[model samples]
Target: MSIKRILPLLVVVLAGLGALSSGPLTAQERPGPLRIVIDEGVIEPLPFAVPDFIAENGAAREYAARITRIVAADLQGTGLFREIPKEAFISSVTSFDAPVQFGDWKAINAQALITGAVSVSGRRLTVKFRLYDVFSGAPLGKGLQFAGTTASWRRMGHKVADAVYSRITGEGPYFDSRVAFIAESGPKNARVKRLAIMDYDGANVQYLTDGRALVLAPRFSPAGDRLLYTSYESGFPRVYLLDLGSLRRRALDEQPGTMSFAPRFSPDGRTVLLSLSVGGNTDIYSLDLATGKRRRLTSAPSIEIAPSFSPDGRQIVFTSDRSGSSQLYIMPAGGGEPRRISRGKGRYNTPVWSPRGDLIAFTKQNKGRFHIGVMQIDGTEERLLTSSFLDEGPTWAPNGRVIMFTRETAGAGGTSALYTVDTSGRNLRRVPMQGAASDPAWSPLLK
Candidate 1:
């Protein structure tokens, strides 16, 4: 089935499912927000000490240390945990079951502690771990254990981070999710694009579509099982929703018009928000698959493209030239007065609402240079996240902690690639691609 083919059916399933609830579940249940979970973003990074994991049985000593390091790195990467350096540990974890020395840890300003035991029997590996609140002198929760193939040590490491994060922050786990984006190759004039999905860290890459036809703006559903993209296969630049798993596609021309592009799924996966252009004028609209109905949310003479919904699904933030110059505007999802939410020297386009619903990240064209920026919901506190010849198409990660977009250089041999940056505008990392890439839309945290 095509992505939007079951799109109609998925909406039915989602209505019964409702907004994702909180809590972690087994493989049978989907991942959702955790009720009464720790707010990792607001909470201070807990200082924790994870001593070198103790190897029981015949586990490789080298592999055990690597697993411990990966676990520590995952926790630290979330910006929610501060790992105590190996030298700072005045005490060592002699055993996983041994009582933690709260006094000693507290003296080193360690707020939490991690201890684990690893054992290997034949091809199977078993890991048991515990987390503790050092400052409170109490166990964080019951010890967690996992049994899997010995080769899955890295996955086991991520699981450890998920447990530590979930116990302290009420938020759901995101460590195990994956992301899909366009992979590019060939020259600038004749670029080839392929649908590339990979684990969040760029591991386990799978090509969903061959880089033959022209494709643009692909985004995954919240479950990461489907993708909504715009393809020119219809010969007139119409939006086509393709099921990543089935190599099937159906044109999303709910509007009988010739052009509909820049497609993205609403947070609930019930509606697809995209732009419809007619007679040279473009506007934003929503396609309600369940009712087989569509609602034009923005009706203006000027161009209004790249419509993104707030996490609550009550309002939308989009790019419009209503002010004589392109800028960001926020309006009710049902259609109403739009308040301008972007300011400063240049025109803003492609405004994407962060999943956390606190900020609107967009591409700003200032002077002659293009830069990516984020602003408060009410249009206050704007900060640039990237700058260059052309930096555009900002997409927010599920946690709203990072922003991913495309960066294109200038000149005869212009270059473009996908890049991700923290909300702080730091840690700009270029994602690997065979050729040029653009219009990256980050997928919602998968269940």
Candidate 2:
């Protein structure tokens, strides 16, 4: 196993409230195992054309065109589509309902076309788009519409493109979302940290907290409105819940002398599972947010951290040094003896349950290196996804086919950046970041 995945091995099931789509994701969505729906069934890159979208009332003729370009970039980024050059467009579209000249598009060997219109009213912007099968001269799907603030028009465009992808390929959409991570500054040895949230592709970065105090492991709620993290601002490490929308937070525990870390929300979002370290020994506990009740789930002299809930919220997986070295263990959410799940030459830490409920994702440290790995519930067929100098933090892509993690490069100027890889260990690419970034928590696909 590679040394890349050690943190973020905790299971997080984000039951997205407004998103109800089912099935895998299409190529026009976000990058993963993209499902390609071809009408002509060409093995080569499919050619597509997107003339500037129509705009009305001078609201911003360029807004529609800018949106079209973004949509084209989103589609072309998948390495599956070849965009027809804007210069190749012989004629122009005045309206979305106008007849598309197939001869012109076919001359340029375009197999698909995306036509849309953009309009702004008050402070809200509305974008409507439709996908068309150029060769067949038929509408591929119904027109998709998304409305949002003018500032978020780009996201609305991506959402529309995702909808087109879902309709064409019978898959899910992954655009229109955010990513929460720990923004770091200074050297790797003593870095200042704060909770920062940004758009999926590294836009709209908002600092949820100042970098004055040390902060670690910030995670987003299923609804993308709240965050749960561990802060040492109170002199000792304690779990703090910060509401991202209003930037308000209160200590999760009123208890004294109890240090908490590795906090994560349960599948249902009503409770949180965290490791409470007191007097050198650590145990896993659950805290109800509304009732403010605490339940101790594990009681052992050994060190245990990173408690993650299963998709059904019945079992919790955590890491323990009880095996002489750190390894993963699973037990009921309530207190009991934990059953060992990782038995191998290397040590494992940060075990996360997959939202699909098919496997347990974890980090393994072998031969002075770390890796991101996954295994079945019974601890069979252990597959390691990534291996690097210091690869850790495995968060699922909403579809479960890809895992996003942080890879720390070595050297004097060594810095950390986000990377995503498929379960097969193929298609590893650096996720975008603003300055040196680490500890990425992928949000659920937004609606």
Candidate 3:
């Protein structure tokens, strides 16, 4: 019996949460701590306030306001926290060491209050911040300070926001990371593509590769210092590994007449998983980078692609049509019998295992519509988070709380854009960018 024909059946069930619209919540509506429960029903976003950061020195005045604004934008953009406008403040904070007027903030319904100070010396910058519970009149945690070069002001701002987010949500921070994607220009048919990297918020964009070759799926290594992408530079799709620090790259798993694509690094960064086609058949393979050895993980006749390693590196989730339709499957990382995990009435592709190891995010096409959905590891609790003309390439944030993907309209004037949504299927928003872009792969939080 063929390996593909003997796999156990794990039926997929189509289920989604009903849309619930929530009005702006008052402080009284959410009277408990600012903890977000993803499994619970939709709740109103928490309200918070951030006044201008106090300048500790004459040279730091310009940075103080900019840093404060960036931090506020980061929190508000998540749809989990609403920023109270400065016009609603009844008291002003001028000193970093001054006690917060909790009563004034409470009067304005600010549940959380952020205060900070910025200092600059030569090219050095330092920022300190404190989070306070306005209702309880107590600090959320000990004050913290971060020091770095002045040129990295935005990163410093992200770090502060990460600290506050971690303290409040009890999840790891994603703001202090980067995203690698395909930066595109020109017409949709003859578009030029280049490998690009940018901050998580889509700022500080830097092109790593010129538009000389067609590159796709720039997957960041676990260490966040290398990239694995498919390039048609050799006139066929081949996987290449690029050293992010030196801007140098080399092809991998090159054979006489084989084509390889869909490359991703294993959790330990020691091995690579990719799809290799030979004699019109494609199967997943793993390569040890250090030894130049390869192992075929699947021996099925059906085309298999988009292999993603689980967090523990013990298993993998990928897409296959062995079941007569494209669906998701899970198997041992080293290769074994596979089991279907996608049970819906549609085609599921580009299955990405969540960083939290609890969910699998994928792109589904059904009823002439494209959707991004999440399901439990065992193929249950499927929830479609988004639907559009074209939505593909789902990537997760470092914390696994949000997902970023590619969305394109269906027309001659359609252009590709990046977007994000909370794991709870809420807070869908577009990512700001300069032009057409797609194929995003988020990196681990920067050290």
Scored by lDDT, the top model is 3
Model 2, CA-based lDDT:
0.74
Better candidate by lDDT, 2 or 3: 3
How much is the lDDT of residue 378 in candidate 2?
Answer: 79
C-alpha TM-scores of all predictions: 0.76, 0.84, 0.92
lDDT of 3 by residue, 1-447 (tens): 221111111111112111211233322343467555555687677799999999999999989999998899898888878999999999999998887889999999998899989999998888888777778777666677787777778877888788777767767889988899999898878889998888889987888778998989899999888899999999889999988766668999679699999988999999999999999888999999999899999989999989999999999999999988889999999999999999989999999999999999999999999999999999999999999999999999999989999998788777889999988888999988898889999999877
Error of 1 at 413 (Å): 4.1
For each candidate in turn, give its C-alpha RMSD to the true structure in angstroms: 7.6, 7.6, 10.5
Alpha carbon lDDT of residue 309, candidate 2? 85
Judging by TM-score against the true structure, name the best candidate: 3
| lDDT string, candidate 2, 1-447, tens digits | 111111111112222212222323333653322236432334355678888888964885758878887788666644456789988887788876777787877688777788888888776677877666777765564555666667666776677666655654454565556678888889878888888877666766777778888888787676656788888888888888977545678889757877998988888899988889888899888999899999988888999889888889888889999879998888987768789989777989888787777788888899978899889987888988888889897877665656778888898778888887756565577876668788888787754
For model 1, residues 1-447, the per-residue Cα lDDT tens digits are 343222111100111111221223332232322122232235456678899888886555656787798789777766667888989888898776676788998899877788887877876776777766676676655667766666556666667777777666655566655566777777778778776666555555566667766778888776666688877665677777766657667887844555998877877888888899988899988888567588888889999888888888899888899889998888988878999988788999888888778899999998899998999999999999788989988877767777888898887678778888777776678864455566676655543
Error of 3 at 14 (Å): 46
The parts of candidate 1 lying over 4 Å away from their true place are 1-69, 78-95, 98-112, 117-127, 133-138, 146-155, 165-173, 244-247, 254-257, 431-437
The order of the candidates by lDDT, greatest first, is 3, 2, 1
lDDT (C-alpha, whole model) for all candidates: 0.73, 0.74, 0.86
